[model samples]
Target: MLHLVTGHAGFIGFHTACRLLERGDGVIGLDNLNDYYDPALKQARLAALQALATRTGGFYRDVRANLADAAAVDAVFAQHRIERVINLAAQAGVRYSLQNPRAYVESNISGFVNLLEACRHHGVGHLSYASTSSVYGASTALPYSEHVAADHPLQFYAATKRANELMAHAYSHLYRLPTTGLRFFTVYGPWGRPDMAPFLFTRAILEGRPIQLFNHGRHSRDFTYVGDIVEGVLRASDRPAAPDPAWTSAAPDPARSNAPWRVYNLGASAPVALVDFIDALEAAIGKPAIRELAPLQPGDVPDTAADTTGLQADVGYAPATPLREGVQRFVDWYRGFYKV
Candidate 1:
């Protein structure tokens, strides 16, 4: 199968594209190589993909283009025999969104609209896109379920992701496009974004700096591994969404629709405390972190737990990596990559 993977140089996109190439799927990767975190790291990921493709004798062509450009997206669709699309490109960061809300609008909203338009016109078979767990914003619910209403988004980033879900649903309903949205929960592992907790904590700990614990170490997150995330993503992409026979408008489930569209939580289903996660990182690095407990930042949720039953039932998605093991793997890669 020929796969069109946006943001192929990103952490999750790199891993997914590598796996697809390893499995003999030809991949055309699209990425702008934006300096959201570090363009060097993104370049390194792209280089690694090229090396992997050469070794495997599989096709991995990368096109440097922004998803916000409608003509660029359309050009790629017109050029390639694209069977499926994995939309992972976005301006990804809750705090960053506060500083530059326009970036979110341009990338997450406008960019997603361009991709949807290309998919609609190109007759793509399955459209799988990345949605964040942050969409379950300000909810006091313990285990976030897909069926629950997600109308309340705390941050602009979350709002844009939620808007993507709605837009995808519209495309699916209007054009019979098979669309699947995977709400990722606290994804972390090697090659992660520097803005994220795991990478920040690891860097601070290694450099003998104090690590800030938001909400005074009271917050909890699902902390899913990237490998597990890629697995779930691949499975979800393979299974084209279908209309739910049980769906009804009277008591509508937000996760599924009468059209060929669905949303599922891709998470570990186990919430780990912020302090515990820090301890795991410390253990992995063989160093103790200097902690500075702080109040929770605005647009930040206190806790998050995923109800992955819907994903499990639909696509056999089960996150199998343990927190300690996953943290160890990340620490190993971080040390090797940074030469720390």
Candidate 2:
């Protein structure tokens, strides 16, 4: 399979691309490699991908460009015979969305439309994109299910992702495009984002710095490991969405469509409390964090858990990596990578 994986240098994207390459699939990676966090980390991930491609004898092309650039996106499609698209690109931070709403609009909304247009014109067989469990905002639902109405987004970041879902549905309905939206819960593992809790907590603990605990460390998250996520992504992408036979317009299901569109929540289906997760990190790293408990920041949720049954039923998605083991792996990677 030949895939166009946007944001291929990102944490999940890097891992996803690597898995596809290892399986002998051609991957065309598109990433602007912006300095949203650290460009060096993105570069390192790109370097790793290049090395993997060389070692595995898989076709891999790194294209440095932003999705917001329509000409650039169209040019890529014009150049490559892309069959599938895995969109992992977006301005990802919730708090950052609050501070710079324009960035979200540009990257998440405008850039997404560009890709959608390209897919529609290029006759792409399947399009799988990253959504978020945060789309279950304002709904104090314990297990975030795809069938539930996710119209209310608490933050700009989530709103943009929800907009992507709606946009995909429109394209799917109008053009008969096959689209799958994977709503990810809190994801953590090796090469995870530095801005996320696991990386932040690990780095702070290693440096003996204070680690901020939001919502007074009371929130729980269904933290899925990267390997499991990549597996789910590939499986769902391999099975392009089709018009749900059980779908009805009279009473629509938010997760399925009369069109070739489907949405599923991807996670471990097990939520761990923030403090307990911290304890796991401490155990993995052999260090204690200088904890600084604080109120939940704006645009942040108190708790998040995923109802992963939708993906399970559709694509046999089962995320079984235990939290402790995943944390240990991440800690080991962090220490080795940073020479800590």
Candidate 3:
């Protein structure tokens, strides 16, 4: 199958595309390579993908364009027989959204709608896009389930992701499109984004700088590994959503609908405290971090956990990498990549 992956230069997108290529699937990677983090890192990932294609003898195509450009997105669909699409392109970051709401709207909302339009027009079999755990904002729900109400989002970033789910549902209902929205928790691993906690903490520790511990080290996250996430993504892509026969409007489940729409939480299910994560990182790096406790930032959740039952039941897989092991792998990659 020929799969189209948006944000192919991104951390998750790069890993997903590489895995697809390793499995001998035709892949068309699309990314604007925005400087949300380091475009150099993104470029390196793209180069790795190209090298992998040559090594594995996989069909790989690269498209450099912004998803928000209607003409660009349409041209991609026009040029390729894209059977499935994994939309990971977004202006991601919780706190960054505070300063740049317009960026979120332009990339996450507008860009997503453009892809949906192309998918609907091109008769794409399945469409899987990234949502976020932040959508469960202000809810003290433990191990958030797909059935839980997630109408309240704390940040503009989370709100955009929630809007994608709604927008996807509307498209699915109106056009019978098979759509799957993945609510990703804290994903961390090698080639990860620098904005995330893992990279920030690692860099700070290596540089002998103080690592900021938000919520006074009380915050917890379901830090999933990127490799596990890739497994779930491919499985979800293979299984196109179908209308739920059990769906009823009286007490409708937030996860499934009468339309061919479904949502699943992808996470490790293991919520580790901020302090514990720091300890793991320190162990991996062979050094202790200088900690600076700080109050929680605006729109920051104190804790997040994923129920992942729906994902496991549907795709027969869930994120399983332990925190210590995953952190070690990331640290090794960091040391090698940056020669630290």
Model 2 lDDT, residue 70, Cα: 100
Residue-by-residue lDDT tens digits, candidate 1, 1-340:
9999999999999999999999999999999998888899999999999999999999889999999999999999999989999999999999999999999999999999999999999999999999999998988887999999998899999999999999999999999999999999999999998889999999999999999998999999999999999999999999999999899999999999999999999999999999999999989999999999999999999999999999898778888999999999999999999999
Deviating ranges (above 4 Å) for candidate 2: none
TM-score of each: 0.99, 0.99, 0.99
Instruction: Please give the CA lDDT of all the candidate structures.
Output: 0.95, 0.94, 0.94
lDDT of 3 at 216: 91
For model 2, which pairs clash?
none
Give the distance in Å from residue 50's predicted Cα in candidate 3 to where it truly belongs. Answer: 0.5
> Which regions of candidate 3 are displaced past 4 Å?
none
lDDT of 2 by residue, 104-200 (tens): 9999999999999999999999999999999998889788888889988999999999999999999999999999999988999999999888998
Model 2: per-residue Cα lDDT at residue 144: 83
Clashing pairs in 3: none
